[model samples]
Target chain A: MREDRHVVSVRDIPETLDDSALIGHSLSEPETFAALFDRHADEIHRYAARRLGPELAEDVTAEVFLVAFRGRARYDRSWPDARPWLYGIATRVVSQHRRAERRRTHALSRMSVDRPATFDDRSADRVTAEQLQPRLARALTRLSAAERDLLLLVAWADLTYEDAALALGVPVGTVRSRLHRLRAKVRRALGGNDPFAEEPQHG
Target chain B: MDDEIRQFAEGRPPAPAYRPEARARARELLLAEARGGGRFRLPRFGWQAVAAFGVTVALVGGVAAALSGRPQEHLAAAAGATQSAAVAEPPAGDLEPRPGQFILVESDTMYGSMTMGRNGEESRHLYRTHRKIWQSVDGSADGLLLIEGREPRPWPGQRELPKDAEGRQSSLWTTLAACPGAPHRSDYTYLSTLPTDPAALRERLYTAADEKDVDRDERAFGAAGDLVRETYLPKAQRDALFEAVKGIPGTQVAEGVEDSAGRKGVALGRTAGGTLTQLIFDPATHMFLGERQTVVDERAGQAPEGSVVALTAQLKVSVADRLPDEAATAEPGGGCPSSAVPPTEQPTPAATLSPPENVTEGPEPAVTGTMTATPAAPPAVKRSPSESAPAVPESGVAATETVPAPPVAPTETAPEPAAPGAGS
Candidate 1:
């Protein structure tokens, strides 16, 4: 009986598991789509808040999923993971509200002198993040939009460069080149030993 | 370098949140669209049947007219007036063809939309562009173009490849040979023929790059001259066009009329080998303005192939040049002024296809001024929901809710005093 139930549950899943399929199913059935909303809404909201701050994030995060729902038909389904697809949509959604994003970035950069670097009791990571925020902000401002998207998607969203390329509709070669240029500039800004000279291994 | 940047930039912050109301509105609109059929779906079977019946009636009427052969006078009238620019130009239906060498420009817009499965979750893109074209008296051609804003990539046409070159498909080689003109940063020209010998063509291209003393017009002429001398013409189609225009007796001075671009020019239309052909020319200057020859296939459902159109001077001529040169130079074989343009800058003509403030489709007003505000823009871009729809019911309801309260307050107070006493 248990084995039968397990098979039934697995059968209920989509024949093809992909970004387009995940979103496509939701669009077809609103109640079913609410499950997706429950799954991704919080994370998407958090991401928007970090990029554009609380006020704009609320609008953009909602808009991203809504637009994704509308355009689900055109989504290429060959890739199984929907995360990169979401990131791509989010990138455009964020780019649309760039003025708001810039304002948020600028506000974060201009930290008050007495501001504490921790949420709750300070951790070492928090302290480093705070210290790095200003200089990193300046360096980010210097990069082109394409370069910024490539570098930051990998950084914040935990996407591989190949995934980032799919999100940006660019060649993998372009993503790699842009990331390289971005890394050198960022490293110089951080005044760090060349940490990136060590290559990353990918399967 | 790319890997290093990606590695170095790892572990940054996340993005922000979305507004609840905006999200709600999007959900509402999407639901409504889903309830209504998708905007671009084909008509139902009943509608198609009605359309077929209507077409039958129209065809019968057309056949009657064909049997009567009443349009011969119109043709004769046009031919009679073809004799003279020195003579006063005739009224409508005058078909005076001029043998003048004039450059022309033409632009075409094509749109493709598809919905694969049910639920109507579709995406659509509108592509609009203009081409600069130059044609000699003998039908030699050159075309230059700049794709405007947000133009999707083009569909590939039929291509022949050698066995060794099967995997190594080079856009650079095909684009270079497609058009007659030099590939300037501001423009890319399309060619119907490639030079018979590739090595010879490359050598000439290299040598021509050094010939900077030539004026824009002369350079264009030289390119066209070289193309005729060097490029292999597929003898079949060129011969047909030549044969079609060859026999019509007496020189016809093409009168000028307004073309699709709103520019006044003389025009001629002909059908050859399943191609609908039209040529526009400026009567005053005897300059060729544009040519559109499209072979449309209703069966294929879109303009798949065998359709051709050219609009331009030898080089691209734009209403305004907004894109940076580097953006243009990114194109293969782009002859951007290398000395003036920095190497890092890639020429991208993002502004080329931007819609003008006021748009016209042959005097029929498609979109009015107020309707074209932020609401008409694609939701992917920078427009707020409120800005898109300025009028909301909330403010209107609030105004009515406020108006009745103050006057009713005093009368309600007297009743309120009695109500507390009675209850006690």
Candidate 2:
């Protein structure tokens, strides 16, 4: 009976089958979690890589999915979108390697010290407000782990406060509060206000 | 601000490189464990036993605060019994403050964490945070928060304190009274108006947007914790909150919890998010003592086993007629200010209880950190294999390769995850 049905990859599962359905499917067929994996791995991996590094990013991304898979039995079917849940797992996974991430950030800043974004990627330099790449990396490193996570999730991961709350297991209010705090910190770190702020340039 | 950061981070030299090998390795390990049937099962019994023992001590503290001989049963009631009757009557016969006044709670919180600095230097440390809140019981929804931090005894890699222009250690005092971003007036009154009947309360809280999905009992308990922490409620409602909380499954009385001011009290412990959150109470008077969150199941959390993630112990909770100290500066209440804050996020016990129904899936693909919103286990659905197994292994290796066809097929439309779509 088991052999009669072919094992389908995650993509084959209908895109319409939101996260909860796939999770439900995974309950019967453990491999079904892979579909959930395929949907979000790239983003999760990117987030992790940005926080930590490519090496740990892969491991952290893998761990996030693995942990999610192992814990699928407890996943709330109520949350059809798995991004918050996956990111939450990814956060925990990243939190475990805090030192490594800090080191990597420092390394990145150091790596960029000689040739700022101005040298390597002119486009990136324009977008980042022309601050030396090291300064941006340093600013990130200057933040607490909690602040960094919130900032990057919003900045890099592009999660809203509500999604961040769901992912972090805190309340939307708390997310708002953290983001408010983070913005202040960012302003302070970047010599007052966002370096790439969009106000019209002065004469 | 976020856009700039995103742009800046993206502009850096190399884009995120996905690792096929790492994913493969993790996949292999998971598949092996999934098929192995008895791979790694997180050992919960050890923590539960410790929690039970610790709870006994905390409950004794609660009993003392309650000045009641009946807390042992209340303690037992917390063990997932769903004591519907307890909703009408708290286990302890404690007195409540007279209505129409301010209730001031002052306490110190200890947060232990491992810090990784910008230069990649990492170390473990402990810091103490102090808090004072003056919440009015009357419907105006007025409140005050005076929070500050004191450097704790140093551990390795602990950093120095950062102060404000006034030479004050990092401090925040916010006043609340129907201010836009301040405490919600409805949050208080809405919670007050909930049905007092335990079962009905469970239905009301659980059927709400996000609450509907998670384990009903835990969500209810978490919600109760939120209401208890955030605002000052009338005695009847307070009792109702506890009664509702007591009915949630998996709650047991933590015997004794010493408040930050070193006062003894009773506590209720619920484990989630890889940490055991103990809602401490005044043992003799049944008043709230701040809570203590300890890492119980570190396998999935940010800390190691037994680490004290954060704990708040209340020093003073008094029913006063007015703002305790109006002259003292408070953070502007209407809109959250863009002020420098101590880096750590204080865990507001009541904040966790808010409904997540308003949030919807948007174009942004990002994740926030949410520890628990576990869908209440459906009657037809099989509990996690580990939950059914009375004897979970040390590493929770119980996941098996063999599959059991779930007894019922889901007839779900597969709504967006953030759409407040009903999972059931």
Candidate 3:
């Protein structure tokens, strides 16, 4: 009865709380999820933007947070990290704009673009994404939607296989099977196992 | 993962930064939602102010679940939220009957009830009766209750029919009376004069129905069901009434259900203590077809599980100027006309009967084939105790009842484990 009496808002929540803790507390104070949004929104927005372009990304980002907040009650709290769950939600939201996603991939594959792939922490490798992106984009368009979601979460969102499973609400084995199917298709399309060789930029 | 694919996924497209405007607009939407935002699509008729408020309350509570793609979890939360809000409001969803002359609602009702006799024995009985009530829009009316008990049949093998067998009555029409304290002193005038504003009507009805001080929402829902079924209402008023009932704490809406008569409709339900009552309505027309009540948990004065405690199939509900031609005359008694009831079968003393099973009766199975198969052989459809249908197969008409069980009562049930059909 006490639980039914009041629904809490964000102001009552402490900033120091962890995501799962924030989610649990948000049950009483639904606004407490604002803290969760502030913690994870940037990364999810970047992921959506990369997949569906900037315009749809904004809508997808907002949808992800709202959906996560609404379904917080069903979230499994035993897991300490909320990122995987948020990414799972973002994956579903991004899924709705499938036409827009395919358009982005097809558009990218047609271009002869050049850009340095200096992912901040992996800078010592000193490789570029320009040479491989076009072919990779074509390969991505050929893969299944479920495969694409899994590969992108790991490769783009930087989630581990286990986290991807948690996000997708599937077992790690299923994630591995999707991964295997994706890589096999890419190999067939690219005509080689190591088609994405990161040639050292000899500057 | 392939490096090219990794770079493809890790690849950043040059897009603008996360805009503060999007974030701000989203927050505004969220806050508005939290504060119960959104305007109701106002209806053209009825009390505008109350209707708007009612619609707003309904939308703010109902819209989120509609929007959520994963409804399994969110719908429950929304229902919980709506129930608490409903409890705070005054009772609602009452309708005012049509204006002018006595609106005669003539119905053929097949009611199944549990009967307990002074012999410390309990039996379930189902009876069919033609109930006609001629009421002026205000509440004053005459009712004719024609129950065929036991009589000399015009043909062979039709003698001494069961109490609940379908039969026409020729008894006199008698004055109808309301239950004690029904709608502001059971006055027809008060019922017709009720405000169409759902909230106000609900509030007023809730107070009257809550006299026992227990199962408030259930009682209020019952009262609402009564008004909606027993009286006639216009379309707009009827819609307002359902919307009002939707606001009650335990009102559950079950879409795509079929009533016992095989007519499809939406079922609105509420459960109190251990009894679940459902009033089915034709969704397209919003007409009340029938209602069923089930005894959910084991409690005193309740029958076994899966027993349909009460069922009423409204054979027909039409507006007529007077009682049907055959049931027109009234005897001297203020109650039911004696001539209207069959003369041979004695009226079972009302005091010995359970509140529900006090209808009509006699002795012979008009169509009896004594067949004894598994009494609990599952019916063609699956049913929760709350969902109902004919309790027992109407005896001999079908091959299903292979054993020699007489078709006295139409009610069938999951047989009590020990008692193989009580050898009456």
Q: What is the interface RMSD of each candidate, in Å?
A: 18.0, 17.9, 19.3
- Per-residue alpha-carbon lDDT of candidate 1 for residues A154-175, written as tens digits (9 for 90 to 100): 8766689789999898988988
lDDT per residue for candidate 3 within B1-424, as digits (tens), equals 3554565554544444778767655554343222221111111111001000000000010112221122222322543444422211111222222222234443334443222233423333443333444544433344443332212121111233334233433433543531121212222333333446778656644643422323567656755765665455654555656766777887889875434334445778887646667787767556665676666765631555545544443433332323444444553212211112233533333332222122223222122121111233222111111112222334342332222222212112212123211110
For model 2, residues B323-362, the per-residue Cα lDDT tens digits are 5454256654422111112225322234322222222322
Q: Which ten residues in a row have the lowest lDDT in candidate 3 chain B?
A: B50-59
True contacts kept of each: 0.18, 0.18, 0.18
Q: How close is candidate 2 to the true structure, as a TM-score?
A: 0.37
Flag the better candidate by lDDT, 1 or 3: 3
- Candidates' C-alpha lDDT: 0.36, 0.49, 0.49
Model 2, span A137-186: residue lDDT tens: 77887788888777676666767778888888889899888877776676
Off by over 4 Å in 2: A1-203, B1-101, B112-125, B139-142, B153-168, B177-191, B207-217, B283-285, B301-304, B324-329, B333-424
Report the Cα lDDT for residue B217, model 1: 28
After superposition, which runs of candidate 1 have C-alpha atoms over 4 Å from their true positions? Answer: A1-18, A26-31, A112-114, A117-124, A191-203, B1-11, B14-424
